[model samples]
Target chain A: METGTAAHDDAAREPVWTGLPPGLLKMRRLLLVVWLGLLTVVLGALLNLFAGPAWAAFALLPLALIVWGWVLLGRNWRSWRYAERADDLLISRGVLWHHETIVPYGRMQLVEVTSGPVERHFGLASVQLHTAAAATDATIPGLVPAEAERLRDRLTELGEARSAGL
Target chain B: MTTPGAEKDVPEAAEVVREQVPVVERRLHPVTPLRRAWAPVAVIIGWAVHDPNQAQEQLTRLTTITLLIGLAVFVPAAGLYGFLTWWFTHFSVTDTELRIRTGLLFRRTAHIRLERIQAVDVTQPLLARVAGVAKLKLDVVGTDKKDELAFLGEGEARALRAELLARAAGFAPETVHDVGEAPSQQLLHVPAGVLAVSLVLTGATWGSLAAALVVPPLLWLATHSVWTVLATALPLLGAAGASSVGRFVGEYDWTLGESPDGLRIDHGLLDRTHETVPPGRVQTVRIVEPLLWRRRGWVRVELDVAGSSNSVLVPVAPREIAESVVARVLPGVTVPPLPALSRPPRRAHWCVPLWWRGYGLAVTDTVFAARHGLLRRSLALVPHAKVQSVRLKQGPWERFWRLAEVHVDTGANGTVTARLRDAEEAAELLREQAERSRTGRRDARPDRWMA
Candidate 1:
């Protein structure tokens, strides 16, 4: 009931493609999680040696966290999608519960395209859109660098036309 | 429903009188002299009253000290007052605009277009009341600072409000009407029951009685003297109680009236204040019903204006009355139905089950009883917007679980928040909401003009 009949009218709306390209390297960013986990476990063991029993319990928390990260990596590897609409863009992800976010071109306050050192090696970039209200902003990570730049230019053009009362 | 044509009873052009131009009359603030002298005088008096046994020996020393302090205070007060009196006397108003020049050490001049004026507020302190002068504050939309013209005759305040209102209505020549006619409607006065309840809640009444009866006896028992703590403490308590009573008595006859120009609020005890706020300047309207007032169905209405936020137009009225006033003042904004008191979400309620999958992180909450303010049981939702920047947090134990915590930073003063919870359905919900908000349309609706 939440979705209107117009939602099913795919021809009237823009084309939506599920899943990111294989070349996108979002999986490499998972290393940051591994580095943080190693630091916590080392620090926890050091504290357990110096302090008493309470410190040992605190140190064991990081070991338990690494297992949680592995589960998320397995789930996200199967369930992420990116779609482009006529007036807006959407990024949908989630294995069990699905979530779809739409970002209209007109309301985009700022669009930033960034490439990290690791991402540059892989020729991938991330796009973030900022809005006046803190809520409802969007970020799409791991796209081909050239594609990211093209999307940014298109969004800027649409934003200017909307502000002029078009 | 009446047709638009039937409702249109336009008056003849000749009969419509033009609005009078507002004239700015300024004078020095009467309280400046008293405020400057109060500190020095209090210091001298305390010195003189101390050590009665050494009074004779320290007479010369005390006199020298008092004179030095008095001169230090008197010189600045005299210089400032002289400069203010000269600078403030030069305000003027034409048919189109108002201009004022004021300052002592740093000279400053300000100009405000009549068309952009949103509201005019007149405030009078205790000294101003005796001197028959009040401070006028004019608010304009989109401006950071308000135009202030301090110290004007009480009659001038009313005249200025009338002139400004008339100008806003676009009055024309060729028609003359009496300035004082029967007011279109009566002002709504604060109810007696609410006032009585407010007094009881203040706790000043009980404290006053306790000080008068119990303190003297307690002093007599402790130090074998009636005049020890009782003499000092009782008088201070009485003075504070009396002032509280005075304020209540002063605000007893508060009333707000709807006039052709805008909303006119008149209230005061020792120093009466008259305020006029036009419709256009209101940025946001908030209607609050504190948990305590739910049974009485009373609500407090506050309007966020451009210049003034503290001096909120607080109209304590019934819930329905508050809603209607808001609808009239701010059109187009949706007014959600009044939430029932009993139906508020409890811990682990039904909505939790549907949304729990999205909540990837463990949520810890601390609940306390609602205080006396408008909102009760505060709920902080750390969504994607709050994520100032996101960071992946992991612990040693989490490495085994293969789970990472997504820390989202929500910026201050905006709905964006930093959420530090386990990555689950909650994190997904936040990301989706943030994406949707980024594309939502910005608010640019035009405000309603009184004319």
Candidate 2:
């Protein structure tokens, strides 16, 4: 089928939305803070090598404290979101620069529902949809367990109906 | 389009039905006895060889230290393995789908519907054969993903094969014929002349034999003592004997069988490998004759397939047989007729590089070769679907005449390269072939073709 044909008008009209689980963002920020802290400590040590002992001593405490603060704030700053429209599932999130990906349901090949230990404890889950084409795939994270299951069923049904020449 | 308000076009309200459907069956793969013993063996060996005097060591009483360390590492590892065995050893085949769930920490479950499966190839490695198990590789069309459901009992493999074929037949009426039926007939078999020619052209057969005889003497000379010769030569002799046995077993036991489902090739001596390729999934077919094999009239048949990208199916047979087999598997995909065979223009003497010439240059060369067809010299170049890229190559000498060769890469399995000695001609040919491949339909459509 020609992808540009009028038959795909419905897909073009769909709005995109996405939401990531809070735990995932928290996990990412925790990693970033730890990395930043390590960088600061390494930089302080390198500066100690070049500067006089007094300068090294003066820099170490403040650098360590700043790193610690970053680590503390990172744990609290995690979050994500999603929205579904007529034709696409839009996912948006990032600590630094936000990214938005729109995935069309018709392109979906497989839908997977997964739960991690934290998600399990919180009764939450994530749904990932794979596409035949490498690009244009998306995952929606941080849904309530029941919502994730419902979405999985709906996506699977929609994928199958579309594949069957709907 | 029908009128919006027509009785047939009236929208019907969705009906609601309440039913209790069973949850999808969960399955875990069975743990092999060898795998279960591997960790314990490694732990015991490590404990026996561990040296405490190294800089990394902790000072402690050896017996107590070993016991504590072993318990700390082995206990959790064994327990985790046991848990994994329980969790991932299961698999389930429902009425309409197959599901494989695996992984310990991040559990992964893959599901494939019966209707989507294009072919199922049952492969048995050495361990699988000894364990009475086989791996089912299901290739589904319209998707690039490959799902491997392993450790099926040999009996289960057969049952699954029949069930899958039956389901396929139900969806596609053309496949209603018994899958067990043999193919119409094999178009070619390795002819004796071809075998002789292959043995001469490629010195591998004789070289192997020569190596077998020379290794013992070579070892004996190296050791310089009659008593030590036995120690040195015995291993070499054993290895050579084993290799010869392997070769013999492979040559004699090799069978290429044809069935309605696909072409089945089974070979190997101690560790047999069985591979099947349904015509539908074969992306491309190539007939190649290496320079050395030219005089012997031997050609290698290779097929590109979806699931077996890492492996190429090469059947060495007579040139004529190779042509016939290619025609049967892929019709109307071979190069057009040529006049006669001639010695390839002297490679060293050609004034301008001919390798880069367009179709016209190739035609001229083919026409020259056609005059001497009985000499057994000819080259056929066939391009496959979708020429995605074209590359031109030339060595330093050819660069003198602004000459370059062309190689066209297609989406198909095998590499389709053409050598044109003339750069301008090669460019023109590349353009023509690329355009033709883009517009033409594939020679064999997967949906209809069957072995």
Candidate 3:
């Protein structure tokens, strides 16, 4: 057959898109403010000591950038969402530039759930799906620990069920 | 190639019979140790020939008697080590899998399932060829490291390769004995003169040669110095020349042939290699036509197979020959012609000002094709069944132009990112490609390839 109708495009059958937990947003924003705030305060004090309070006002520039980045991160987080389908996984994200990757369940080689020291502190984890091709950049970030493990297990199970040879 | 009627009718029974055969463990040829030892010695002799006087002075400095004694002891020690390694390494083929046991102190066993084997390659280095032995490399699925059987008798290697392929294809063990050499018909042979000319005519060679010739003279004029010309230009010229010479020697006597087992490519002057690429295993095929070669209507064809990357199907051939070879390699697939390709919108030129017109995408029933590049134009065709994933990307500039790129990714070689399509069209292509991939996979040949 040269062409066929989209079998899985029905709106009723489409799965709900899952967005990252708001706790991740709070943790990330807190981290940004703490790091940038420390830098700005220290740099401003140094400038006040060496170059006067007038030069200390220059430190406000970084503070302004931090504020802008804080808002940008929220938008990027909102843009990041994933939806599991009958045979493939869809990950759509990006603010200025949009990217939507569809990795078939049959192609998944490994599914991993990882939590770094900071993420562990924040009680947040990320799920990564790897395929034979590196171009399938499928990573769902900032999920609750339980949700990440659940997703990993479910994906691993589905991957084994539909596993196809390369 | 005997396709026995019994096996064809009853694949299940054939599998049962195939699994019952157990081959005994076999060591490499006895000459393997000597060949391995001689390989390094040959390299040393070649190096010593370059600076014989320095070698002589170094020998004299060491005292000839002592040097002779050291060589006498060292040669035997290396030989013993090689012998030990050879003795420990053994390979056996079972009905279900091929097992290679290697290592001296710590034991290691590599088990490659018969059905998971993508290809079997036979390669012979100069020393191996001289010793009438060849190395067998098994390209197994799901493994980045290749399993190699080093230094088997040339004929035995071929026989073993054929036997393995036959079993992998689901033939009954009995019928496999009838498949001797698997008679292949020669499709094309590249002449030495043509290969040499093609190498010299490439844009890279021309640019490098121009640099070597012009840079030295320009420096001599600007600095009024002969030392600068000698110091900089000679090495650049030699390095540039060496690459072309190496390719020429490596790709000498290039031959493309077709056999029941797969498409066979035999090449190399010093280290001969015989590569078999099954049509089903090819992930993508790229046909490249450089600007210089366009007038001659010649193009280079390359295939990205499942386990191996960037395997050259033909060094250079007529466009028709390339097209036919590609069609042969990818059976039942039709590559859309260049003129029928869908080009990007004219206003999308803002992103790629010079080459926007060159970018094109074509989606056929079985293949997703992308055409791009101004100087070295290329058309890459990926069979939908071989597609691993689909991605749609739109950058800020592309967003400004309402353009997006649809990337069709294959297993290993690279992604085909067709850029500067309308945003909606790009999304549609991504969906269509993913859908096609699913359907293609369903209709593809089974993992038991021969069956």
Report the error of model 3 at residue B166, Å: 0.9
Query: Candidate 3 at residue B438, lDDT?
Result: 70
* Interface RMSD (Å), every candidate: 9.3, 14.1, 1.1
lDDT of 3 by residue, B1-451 (tens): 2335456568797666555545689998788787656655777788898898898877778977898898999899778877887898899887668899987688888988988776778999997888899988888655544368888999999999888887787776566777666789988898999888888778787677778888998898899888788988988798678668777887899999998778899999999999886548888889999888888888999888767633798998888877888888888877688889989999887888989988898888889999999789899999888888899999888999899999988886479889899999988787778778876888787766778
**Model 2 segments beyond 4 Å from truth?**
A1-166, B1-83, B92-98, B111-120, B139-147, B165-201, B205-252, B288-296, B309-314, B334-383, B392-399, B412-414, B446-451
Measured against the true two-chain complex, the DockQ scores of the candidates, in the order shown, are 0.08, 0.02, 0.70
Residue A127, candidate 3: C-alpha displacement in angstroms: 1.1
Summarize candidate 1's per-residue lDDT along B1-451 as a digit string, tens digits: 1122322345442122213323445554544444434555566568767865576566656677797997888868766665554554446554446677665556666776766666777888777787777777776633344256666676776566565555544442111022322143434677656755654544456567566667767777788865687576768677666746664665656677766566777776676776776654453445555455556776666554445533434435777776666555544433444241112122222333433222222221210011112232122223221122222333444334333333332222223222223345334534434343332223322222333
lDDT (Cα, tens digit) per residue for candidate 2, span B1-451: 1112323222241111101234345442364433443666677567655853552354344577787898799777776676565556556655446676666677777777755554566767777788887767776644333357565677767666665555443432223324433343443444444444454565455556676578657867677678676765566566655444544444434456666656666655556655555554554455555667766566666665543532334446766666666655544544334332122334423533443222222332111101112223334344333233334455555555555555544333334444424556655654444334333333434443432
The top-ranked prediction according to DockQ is: 3
Question: What TM-score does chain B alone reach in each candidate, compared with the true chain B?
Answer: 0.55, 0.62, 0.86
Model 2 has a DockQ score of 0.02
In terms of docking quality, how is candidate 1 classified? incorrect
DockQ of 3: 0.70
Off by over 4 Å in 1: A1-166, B1-101, B107-118, B140-147, B163-184, B191-194, B197-250, B280-306, B310-451
